[model samples]
Target chain A: MSNQILIPKLAIVGVGLIGGSLALALKAAGVVGEVVGIGRGLANLEKALELGVVDRITQDPAEGVADADLVLLATPVLTLTEMASRVLPHMKPGAVLTDGGSVKGSVARAIEPLVPEGVHFVPGHPIAGTEKSGAEAAFATLYHRRRCILTPTAQTDPEALRLVRRVWETAGCEVVEMDVEKHDRILGAISHLPHMVAYSLVNAVSSYDRYEENILEYSAGGFRDFTRIASSDPTMWRDIALTNRDALLEMIERFELSLAELKEDIRGEKKDRLYDFFLRSKQSRDAIL
Target chain B: MSNQILIPKLAIVGVGLIGGSLALALKAAGVVGEVVGIGRGLANLEKALELGVVDRITQDPAEGVADADLVLLATPVLTLTEMASRVLPHMKPGAVLTDGGSVKGSVARAIEPLVPEGVHFVPGHPIAGTEKSGAEAAFATLYHRRRCILTPTAQTDPEALRLVRRVWETAGCEVVEMDVEKHDRILGAISHLPHMVAYSLVNAVSSYDRYEENILEYSAGGFRDFTRIASSDPTMWRDIALTNRDALLEMIERFELSLAELKEDIRGEKKDRLYDFFLRSKQSRDAIL
Candidate 1:
């Protein structure tokens, strides 16, 4: 172990809320030697710089990674594979590359082939975000007290993996390392399936004939909670659902089965059964809290 | 209009969160000459009095309503109808009696035959509560800025309805008057259906093989919100789902259709369709906020 902190010059691709927040955290912790932000739009890149998230901005991937020791791919899942390939040639020979994509299996497979020799590639998912998006929503403490799961393949370098773990730990995150397939499966149950259910719930109420307006008007009670989940970025969620299709579909089937059982109890006027289910479910929630 | 401020001696049955909170609000606003709490157990009644939520406590509903000018039936939905009959004979002539049951249609129908001719019956549902229950959870400002819907049948006296509205208004609730059927339907959509979904979602996740333990660990992202909703009183929610069966079943059917559409989009790998659905749902949530 080095006595001096390993301050890597980092390039953050797609400086949105997650990317920009990572840049800010890295700078705040003095773990990065220089932070450069790259994005498709110049205005977003300039805004990132103005917010002091990054030291510099570049439009060219090659130029952005010219002196970088670590590359953080923080784009949407749909763009991660393409962007990973585009930035591969520019990355330093021994530099470590990682991503912030929610779905890992597809992203890991897509980026694995594109990485050059001697460079380590790790896929990671930071399980934290608010309903808000964009660089304006970026904050240095966004990942604090949250879990960031790193899915490193068998080919990943031990030293490079240790450096990535140190980066997330400096941001005050609990780092959990897992295989890529397990990461996707667990996330589908906790994150991806919930998003799909919330979106469907909103669509269900909105499509009703006369109750649509009233539902929205009186949503403060319980419906509003689902709405907050449903209000996440559409493209991001769409990409997640499509990318993790099998696991999400399986969870949806489980949900439907439970829903059908509840509907039957309601129809049969089985108050005792409904009460038992509610009690068990409430106990589960308490256990979680 | 009475210039005397119409400070009625009030009786609140089943003085838990809703009933106890109402008693506090009535006393704070000086709208009640005396407030007496009636409960099945002596402990809750004594606790309500000790907490200053009620001026006195009574184990007998008949004894509690003997001299009261206004009586509030604040028991569970299943018990409210039977309890209404038991207390009506003891209620003073020219007194106004109302309830805080969530399902208005069943309660109104059940209580209609038991009401005496001289007394006025106005069924009301105060759409205010915390996850916490019992007298200890009661707060003076719980109903402030919250909506309280009154569902009065055609037989309900206009003067009695006016008095009930005035009481809730003094308690700082925006009062909305609607028919019993419409109130039940609307509440089924916003409150009942959401609770069912939350309970089912939790149950579905619990069915997974020990993965539920991990799901709870990482629930803060989105699933925790649903769990909180699921943690509501089991007896109360069970009665709600069973009583409001038609509307809940209808909502569930609509939800299943929407879920099927989402599943199809995921299965077909149609990102555009999924994105559009998420976008529309997000807009609805923003509109609600």
Candidate 2:
């Protein structure tokens, strides 16, 4: 790799788990000329610096991205649009601007109009995370062996797309490209629907008047697995649920149909139907592993 | 413990994962005078003897339990009632009979009438298992640090209950006693309901046509967690759902209500409501950990 392309100066906003981890990975690979961290909270910025995730901390997004060759918007999806608008004015001419947002369609719409004529914008989502959040929870290896999806609009610059792909690839993620709308629908089926199921499963057990004691005692049975997914960041998930409402509703409708069929099998004591579903589902999991 | 009490002659029916595991643990602990394994299949019997899970193998339940002081019914729930009935007439008069069934209420009712006057019948469930099944999957440490619930009827002998508890405790489980009805309800809420939800979630994604490929590719986002649970033994789970129909149905109703509320929140774009539910659910997970 050319030194100029390898050691590009980068600015990361939010400086939380995703952003902090990106900085650490870039620095560890010796691909970062300088990593400027920006966040609303001073404590988080300080923590990122102490963890060696970033070379400098800045409260102002403009100052953070002032001279950077690439700027990554790593804030919550709810704030990504506004944050992109705020930082667009300060980005260096021809610098590529990208985001790490869960949902890409709305984000692409939100940032496209605000970007300077010379700057390129790409929307990306790294399909990896933990139940815990914050800068302290980040590590250099967070993105290793994970998948990162990049969604670029028709007008997106090819060079900008390549640069973003290279960044994630160098961070040890397998990079794939797809259309924004298609990405949203796919993520809704695989990610959003599962989270909804987990949250609902927890709510079902908690709703029972006398279940609290027994639930805690016998949780090892199976409920504990759902709880781990249900324990994800509340604000992030809430934003996802609202933003991907159409796809989520459609998925939920299909889920209800399946649930009803299962209930019928149980009600009618149809062991064969239950057995077939269970065995088939297990094969899918085995394929994944 | 006295040698007579600690090393009682044992007979294990079915000789699959649970049965083989029990025999292995007993032998490892030197807590059994001898272990006689009984199953319908000659192959399984040969495998059990080859693996040393049992000291001897027998095809006849009558001959297997004839000389044993402790008989363990570790077969599937569908076969428990019939097998117990078959072996009851041949079991020693003072022998203790117990089962490892997921649902307790039905098992207790099925075997209660068939048990002999002097022989003790205690229905139990060890809340421990892996996705894998069969004798090949058996391990002596299967029940280590796991919870085992013994659901004995009021007529169960005190001495028999004590001996049953001691056996499970020796196998490295925390033993608790509960009414058969309560055990069924509790297990339904925690284990049965969660498994059903996981199956529903997987089916939901599998039904989507447009984005199926993408969904499978990005399953690591969160969907993969549910797949592992959904991949459990189909025959065993189907039996559980059918035998515990009432309790499972009650839980399904509660889950649907909760899910509908969540759907409404998403459709209405109620961020705060979704956030609050996620936060509350996350708190419960933290408590579990």
Candidate 3:
């Protein structure tokens, strides 16, 4: 194809939403020669194949990465430690390796030692996803008008970083790079902390004594709108929460302090204080909304 | 028109989102004779009339409720206390009075003494709204298939309670009744507490140093969805937090406890505990998602 950017053979570890969408987007752009999926589930990989998300499926990472010019780790944060050890050695010499996990600091630290000299390892996060998971949830347009943040370490090869950036850019993502540690703290505050609070808030209502009778019956769209992230993938969030523990904890503490101030304001019936707090929140949210 | 349920002369104070939507719904259903809007802003009333949300506009409660068959106090919760005292003297004898505020116990208590012996007074909360407010935000379908909760006290007039229920029912709401105290507690857990958490969470992110640089740049739909309620009316929420102070405080404590447990799970790297917590949250949210 004219004006096409090609990966001779692309290897995607974990052919679910992130991986499958990447594969679909690349294929739709005529930018990849072959896309191979390395995942545990045969049914899922087969479904990925049926949906044109992957050209082939393999149970072995070595086999999948043998001829891969690009090997993208599209798995959970905690799983990347093991995935790095398994996939890095098998990657072709001069191949570019990257990841698509939310917390980059841990992934960059965990996978750095495993990368061979010629292989370029860049940790990245695509800020796009639905509550839905699995290969069936893949969509070529998932990354369109979205951001893909690349967190490349000092060891990253310049050419490899450029190629990785092109891949996401070609997939219709606006790519920006940042320090790995900064990425974790950023994602932890905006993404992970909000997720934790949404889940906990829903759980608080769920476990309340009169929830089923009192709370659930009176729940309107506002509650639903506020807690929709509670429906996110459980295991995925657990891994994210753990992998980004320190940052998440710091964010949680800060959030708790804010909540405490609000509680005290309510306790004191401080209308002015309460109004200021609410107005600040509204202004902040309004900017983005 | 034979089986139509009509409000012969309905007076709606504070023609904002709730009042405007109620008038729109009633008008669409051919169930209201003449709706008079009483709001502080003449432009808002004019807009409500333009949108066909109200048939008439008036500045004075005495003028609006003079010959009304029903007077819906659609003002902010804190204002409802003074509004009840002001409007009750103007209502026709035996006219039914109700409200569309989120908090029930306080409004019911504040207005109970002011309500004349011949008049029926019922307190209510229509568990429906959008982030947008004002007369312009009203829609004819805002209450469709939604629940309208009536929190009638022991002193509430039975005929007024029935009539208030029918008003919401005629607007296409599924009506349910609960004790005033119970309604506050239930709504505090599900609705009020969730809103508080959302606003606090957003404020936390907004107050963070270089948040626009570090956080907002990478925000995904998940964060946006979870924080949408943070954009709700500032004064309305401040009033909600104060009027329902005790119940909201109790609910906030319960929510804080839940968040603490989660934080502990993350800090301890208790994978199983974290997984279970997320799973329960997912299950709870799944039932409603």
Candidate 4:
């Protein structure tokens, strides 16, 4: 734990899963003095207040971050620019503004210029989530043993970055840093593309003419995992796809070409080749484990 | 629980994960008096005996099932026919024989006629396993809270089917009965096709010229699950693919069509169509959960 509480007045915009969880973790560690939960929905804001995820609630970002030292934009990627624009004018001179967007490049580009001269704007993404969402689904352990990547530009203030890193480190996250563009491409290959594939696989199964209903009953190990991924929040994933369109499209092409090769091998009954390829995949998977 | 210990002498032909787990579960339940594990490797056999997965070990199938009331053929799908032929002649009168292979239709056809007049040959598959293999990787709880599918043809003896069902039930499995062809078709859509897609996805990433090493590092949520499936037993999957080639090939073709549709949607910037499709997938996946 740090020597003292770093965030005396922490303002959490869009107090959903990520926001609520960060507040809970910091509060549990006694590192956050006051958490002000801000959201468009009054019901969810009330829930966050009742659950002690925040000490206060606000309907507007402008009012929420008025006196806060750190303001975190934890809403959808599409809304970050507007949220940041509203909060920046009300924020104190030396306040830090960060985000927890899944895709950072677009968010960073949209909000970086809006951040006041003295205020620090660091775009971050915590690589942790369940299929569940909203404040009720959040917990202090959501970010425990997970990674939180902060994409800082050349103009980023050192103290701002350090403060954000300390916040994540105290939450039990391994902080990673990368250029925004590289983060997009890397996440395109791993996170975004895989989500697309999973959704497509489920769609593909549903389009089957003859054996639709029987498929789920026979689903044991492999198909079950696919469904679990495919069941993730669709709107959130759609926004991610659209925001990171180019890198996603490129990764999709790469994936399809690889898929074609395996299809060819299977159709041609190249047993030895198929075995070798499958073995290589197994080895790659083992490497990760 | 079955009031009486059903099997006095149980012989398992291949002492691998599924077979070893079944032996351990039955022995722990006090349902089997003697367990004879038959395998080609002396080292594995010794480990199985030491682990008490079996009471004794034998290299010869004839010697293994000589005095057994129940015999389980838990070998590869491709080896079922030969293994059955080897053990059938030596099986005791009124003994029951079953298998724990993934693909049932081919194995059922291959070994059905080899069953003696009074013997039962039930083709079964327990839908539970980790990527880890061999006797040491097995546990008594492997089959707990899992489904065991048994396919019995018209020629199958009633008592043999009952005894096999009882064995799986005693091991804390929910025993399900399906026709042999139906099992293959359903498994083709759900199990075999998913494995192929996962392997293809992994191979696709590896083929990327610019992003091979960076790809694995960025792997999160969905990618991790895909790699886990891709890491499964290669030879076993290869055998399932070959033995159930017709169904696997058909399902693969079905999956390719679905993938092609999604690819077109993404290329054309069909956001609404993609969203609706993704939503449908989420709904389908939720249905399974």
Best by lDDT: 3
Instruction: Estimate, for each residue in B1-289, the C-alpha lDDT of model 1 and write its tens digit.
Output: 1234465689999899899898888788776788989999888888898899998888889999998889998888999988898899998889888999989988888888898879889999998887777888899998898899998788989999999999888888999988888888778777787788888988888767634345667655577875588888898888888778898898889889999999999999987898899999898777887
Q: Model 2 residue A149 lDDT?
A: 96
lDDT of 2 at A7: 43
Query: Using alpha carbons, what is the TM-score of model 3?
Result: 0.97
lDDT per residue as tens, model 4, B90-207: 9988898899999988888888877888777888998888777888977998888889999989888788889899899999899999898888987787777788888877776655
Q: Candidate 2 on A171-274: residue-level lDDT in tens?
A: 88999899988989888888888888888888778667664473665778456765688888898899899888898898899899989988988888887888
DockQ of each: 0.76, 0.73, 0.85, 0.63
Residue pairs clashing, model 3: none
For candidate 2, write residues B1-289 as lDDT tens digits. 2233474789999888888898888777778898999898899889889988898999999999998999999888888999998899998889989999899998898899898899998889999887777778799999888999998788888999999899998888899988988888888888889888887777767767884462676777466766678777888888888899999999899999999999999999988899998888787667787
**Which CAPRI category fits model 1?**
medium
The reply for model 3, stretches above 4 Å from the true place, is A1-3, A211-214, B1-5, B210-214
Ordering by DockQ: 3, 1, 2, 4
Worst 10 residues of 4 chain B by lDDT: B206-215
- Which 10-residue window in model 2 chain B sums to the lowest lDDT? B1-10
Each model's TM-score, in the order given? 0.96, 0.96, 0.97, 0.95
The top-ranked prediction according to TM-score is 3
TM-score pick, better of 1 and 4: 1
Residue B246 lDDT in model 2? 97
DockQ of candidate 3 relative to the true structure: 0.85
Give fnat of each prediction, in order: 0.79, 0.77, 0.89, 0.64
